[model samples]
Target: MADLKQGSASHQHEAAAVIQKHFRRYQAQKRYKQQQSATSTIQQHASRFLARRQAARDNEQEQRAARFQAVMSRHHERIQQLELEKRAIKQLGAGELEAWQARREAAATTIQAHWRGSRQRQQLKLSHPALATLRPVACSSPQPADEPSCSTRPISSKVPSNHPLLHSVTAAGVTGLHAEPSTASVAAWPAHRAGLEQQPSSASVCSGVGYSSRAAAMHGALRGEASSCLSAEASRLSAVGAAAQQPADAPRRTAALPAARRMVLERQVQLRTDAFKAAPNALAAARATQQESDQRLVHLLEQHTAAAAERLKAAQRRQKLLQDAEALHSQLQQLPQLSQLPDNVTGAHFALPGACGARAQRSRQAHALALAEAKVGSKWWLPLKALNQQLRDAAAAAEQDAGSTSGSASKAAAGALWGAAGSTGLLQQDWQQQELMWKDSWQRIREEEQQRPGLQELMQQDQALRPHVVIEQELSSESSWHAASMQ
Candidate 1:
């Protein structure tokens, strides 16, 4: 039994040794795996750290390059701007700059001068000369010391019958066809003669007869008193021919006058006789022309006055129409509930039976009246049409909803509210008032048209006369009498 126990103990000891040996081997293998893992983790951490450092350096290099490029671009743009400025400064010289400035100033001055001259000419045409004073100068001889200076002489209230001006006034009878000057008068013989020399006779006549008459008076005075009568007779005959002659012929005429006074007088008498023979026909034609012009002027004045009155009437009518429309709009705006009604009337609240029917009837009536009003030509036509359309649409929707669902409590309540609003008679009253206003406007417009002249009459009168009338040039009664005597 001892021997068996010893063997068993030895087997147990060997089994324990083997088991312990396997356990040590397993522990060593786990330790080796742990060490390898630790080495690999250290290697990976070092590689990752190196990679992060390299990426950071690369990013810094890229950023520096981008910043350098940005700096270079900015510097390039600044340098270009500086170079362009330098070139521009070099291109513009002092003399050229001054010349450009001078041209600008000259152009401005020329434009200003042109406008000023036009304004001055307009002013001269509008100006009325209250008095004309002429200072005469003796062309043939110097005046004696005892004679009064023409400049110092007081203006005469009336032209004297024996005045030298009479001869010329009679010679050039056409000169008298001007608005008579005021009471003040003075002899400005030399200035008048100078003006006659400078200006064409036709232009002078158109400018003012006062100037022409004064010029004629100076011309008669220059011929001397001894030959004044003969010269005056000759002047009447030659006046027309003289006016027609060029300014260059004036010197020649003046030079020849001293050599052949009698021959000139005879020729003038013959011319005067011939002019007298033709005077009746010319006078008849002028009278006919003047009559036609007077008729035309009257017609044109009537047409213009009628047109202005019509325009005024039209403007008044438009204003009245606008006022009526605004009043109607105001009445509509006052009904807040009606205006607030939904586009789809099925959503409206009514509380009683037949309420929807009543509301629909009122809406239809309002819509009908609005539609009628829209037919009128007014600025409010579109708005009125829109309002009427909305009412019609709401009425239609209500009718459709009532047909689709005959017993909706909410719809009945909405219809009751609309009916209550209509039953108050406010909407009907507003409509009646608007209708009355429209009728009154129409009546007023009709009355105005009735009181004014008919378009046909005005059109006929316009067609018979000219659309535009020009005033006929007529000689004054005094001038006509003088012309008859000369003829």
Candidate 2:
């Protein structure tokens, strides 16, 4: 009985163990299933969240793209309009091109002068030594009208006192003139020496010959000899004069030295005159060259002027065109967000803005603006074209404004015109308030128009609507569909 009980207990214990094991296994499986269910729910929720997030992101991007497209479209349209304006502006204002050319020529002329000055300086250096020697002595020495005032000069300290007559004429004044030479005689010696120096001594000797027969022959020879001797004596007298004028302590002149010094002075003067006459042909040629240069300069200036005028005109035309383009772009900016606009609404109701005073075709403006506005949606945005147009328009408008109130007459006219236009609104009032801002500037446009009927015609052809016109359209779009006008 004990064994059986024990066996039953063992069996119960084993069965209990088996049931416990099975329960444990079942609990583990149920736990695992619950874990999987929880994991799946988490994954599903995460997926839903991800999908919603992606959708939201996509919508945001789409909105951004739409706005970008509209901006880009506006830009492209503005570019095209500006391009048209640029073409028209290029056609107007003939003087602007001339002015530009003149500026270029002036610049070239300035450069040429700089180079010429540099070349002249270089030449001055090279010729300085020769010029120094040839330059006339300053008349610093006080003159005494009587006695042919020979200024006492310092003989060139360069020549040794022992030097021969071949020394510089300037340094050794007529050291050989008269026994008690007056100052006037010394001054006159240089001019007189210049005339007599080259003459043969035979002429002076012949002038003193005697005229008897048998005694005449002998007398003639003797007279000739005596005349030679007298000439020699005269030459000696000039030397004595030169020596006398020297400082009291200086050495006395030898009799023969005077004649030699006189000969030297005479030779020096002859050389100067010869030099003066030597270059007639060169002077004539230089005059001819200068004349030719003058003619060339005149011709070149005329060509430069004409070319400059043409360039100025083109620039003015471009400015006008840009003004029109700016006006158009500004108008585009004023337009309501296309994304906010209903698809049912056509772009035609929008007014086209111009940088100039002229109006463009509404249909064309619509397409251009719409296309520009649409480009913003694309991945790549090209703002260059639009920005360029904007810049051009602003420039043109500035020019026009400057012209309108630059002068007293212009200011008066502008005031009258504004009064006639009548500031009816806040915006017009704002413009009027700002009109005084540019009161002093003279605009080429108005000046041209006022002075020349042809210019006015050209301006009419080139000018477009004001850049502010675009804002007018946007501000009025709610109540009225504003159309840009050509008038």
Candidate 3:
């Protein structure tokens, strides 16, 4: 019985040892499993963090690329606009210069025509027949009273005769000789008449011897009177006799004396009178012509001055525009390159704020917005809102794509899909379509708003309604509409 009890205890001990060994092995396996689970969790977390970081980096790179592209496009557009402006400026300047030259030529032609007309009128006046006839006579001839005396003298008797018939015959012959008219007679007739009146007349001559001496004295006195009166007549007759002797030498002078002298004096007076009358008329005509020409010249000068001023203003404006374009180009050239800019700069700096701000800032924005609306109209907001919505949609779509991806293979597939979408220009096409739609909507809105009542109408209404105390219902309604539209 002692041997059986000892063997049973030994068997119990072996079973206990086997159970302990099994328990230790089970504890070691539990520890190894826990460690493996912790390692796997850590690795998963690391992979997820790496994916998020890579996505963030890709988003930043895309944003930088988009900004660079936008800047380049804006620069290109500005250059094209500047080139167009320069071409327009050059065309305008050339046109203005040509117009100015044409105007100057026209003015010169007008002035030349005026001068030519004046000169022609003066030449016509100088060439007048009446003036030509009067000119030489007035310049070459002496006064009628200062004419040259004739060369002949009257004869007187040495002894006196006492016969009444002879004395009467002699007196009648002497009076007849003086009565013959001539150029000298016309000049000296008045002096001779005065001298005859001053001399005493002889009563009668006696036929006896004692009357011979008295008759001789009376004959002498009568002879003196006859000599004074007939001097010019006798000389003229002697000249006629001499001209008859030498008719060939002075035939024209002798022939012209009888008819031409009287006619020449009369013609001279008439021509002088006519010329005097015509001179005033010609002078007045010339003065009127000059006045008209001066007025025309003044008007032309005024027009030219106005045109020059307008051209000058246009040139100045073009110069200012060119300067502005050059300045913009220089500024663009001075800017830093996109690749050289800092990478860590927050893209939020480029984002514009909406309505949320401090009170002052909000008021300022509201004021700016109102001004923009007044200038550009209500259509400006449409494109802005559409762009913002498109951006939000793109972000949501990206997030959705990222969330849909699961393990490494799925994530890689999602990345490839995103790359494909970008490479295939799907997002760009959508963005372009959105922009086109926004532009179309903006254009439609702008056109519609332009057809509405403007500030000019409001100002007109204000002026017309100033005197009246009561406001019209139509005006009130329009004002409310305007206020609503502005809001």
Candidate 4:
């Protein structure tokens, strides 16, 4: 056992070393690839930025030219406001736009309030079972005419003490059973029960049956034993009911009965109550049978469902993998010849920086809020905006100081003796396991761009083509053009 332990430890160490070797190799390859791509990625980002800046400059020039047009619009609006004032229309009075908006807001609020009230009332009706009784009930329409019905009134009577199954239903149907039996059932079942309850007067009752049953119910883990307990209790109950029906003078000799007869009698037990069988007002027997059968099936299936579901999921996963493999094999010619690295440095290694940097966030919410409150009619309003901006920049600088790897790297190198095992070294995992072992993300994105539909074909057909636009000059010059009616 000592040798075996040593051998296993050696094997584990060997596995760890091999894993580290592969990880280091992958890391070196990744770093080299990043170095190669950094130039191009940075260039692309720089070009995009410069293009956007140029576009913004052009937009500013166009806006300057449109200023004269805006002045003309203001003049046109003043003329319309003056003309409306002369009319003295109620809706067209002072603060006309505000009034229209207020009326619209009021109408919307009223509609929403009415909808909520109606919904709440409906929900209240559904929630209360008593309300269902007050609502007029028609005779049941179709489907299982023999099924139990409570008629217009729910059951509220007390059931026999011997019948536990029917007890709760008789009181208030809280057990979700029939409130009333079907037309075929006997409303009074005690007479039939009285016959089955008879047992030999000389025989003794089973001792501690009630205590054993109660204890088992409270703590028993065995399901089959619980059912046996139920059967035993039923037989005991039937014998009890029979005792009341028989005369005290009547004699029953247990010794006179044949061995076979006695054996059959001993084994015989009533499975159900008379009320439960051939229910006249409902299919109580069928429902009970179905319920038992369902419970049994559920119990049986519960043992195997988890294993079966796991197998099914595994099979589906394998099928998907195979399908993906086949598709890739078929489209080999269209696929990328080489894997490209992402220039984005965001990865698990940044987690420490994120945690450490939280002390210095961009928000100066309290200061900004104070400035906002004091801004109205203050000479320092212009300076308040600048103060808010200055605080934000200061916070950014502090965050850079807190979260940066540059400062930490120097400190870490100084303490290299104590911190030899780095985040990606002996302490942490081999690599972040992503698609194609961290390969597919960049390649797939590139492939999607290259194979993007329509644009390439359109460029080939007419490379000089540019989409033409015809803006309505009147609409741009006048905001009220939206209210224009067609002739």
> What CA root-mean-square deviation does each model show from the true structure?
46.4, 39.2, 37.5, 40.6
Task: Give per-residue CA lDDT, model 2, range 134-166, as digits (tens).
Answer: 322233556532211222233333234543322
User: In model 1, which runs have C-alpha deviations exceeding 4 angstroms?
Assistant: 1-261, 336-487
TM-score of each: 0.22, 0.23, 0.27, 0.14
Residue range 25-99, candidate 1, lDDT tens digits:
575576569667776776676678679979999999999999999999999999999999889867999998789
Clash number for every model?
13, 58, 0, 12
What stretches of model 2 exceed 4 Å from their correct place? 1-257, 303-307, 330-487
Tens digit of per-residue lDDT, candidate 3, span 1-487: 3334544565576466446456645755765686577767766766786799799999999999999999999999999999998787677877787897799999997787666656654554543322433222111233232232322111112112553323444454432322335556445655655776575533232222223322332233334433211333334444554454564665354432343333333332333333444455555666778799999999999999999999999999999999998788556445443234454433232335564423433343344333333333434444344434433454455556666553344334333433312332233355557558756765775685467465456447646764452344345556666776797
Model 4 / residue 101 / CA error / Å: 15
Which residue runs of candidate 3 sit more than 4 Å off their true CA positions? 1-256, 260-265, 336-487
Regarding TM-score, does 2 or 4 come out ahead? 2
Taking all chains together, the TM-score of candidate 4 against the true structure is 0.14
TM-score of 3: 0.27
**What's model 3's overall lDDT?**
0.49
Per-residue lDDT of model 4, residues 1-487, tens digit only: 4444655575576566446456645765775686568756766766786799799999999998799789999999999999886665655656886787799999997787666656655543333322232222233554232221213132222223454334433453223221322222322334443544463211122112222222232222122122332333334344444544567776841112123322222221111222223123243444566699999999889869988999999999999999998777456424221223233322221222131322322222333333333222223233333433443344445446666656455334323321221221321223223223323544554475466544435445433432221123233324333433321
lDDT, ranked from best to worst: 3, 1, 2, 4
lDDT of 1: 0.48
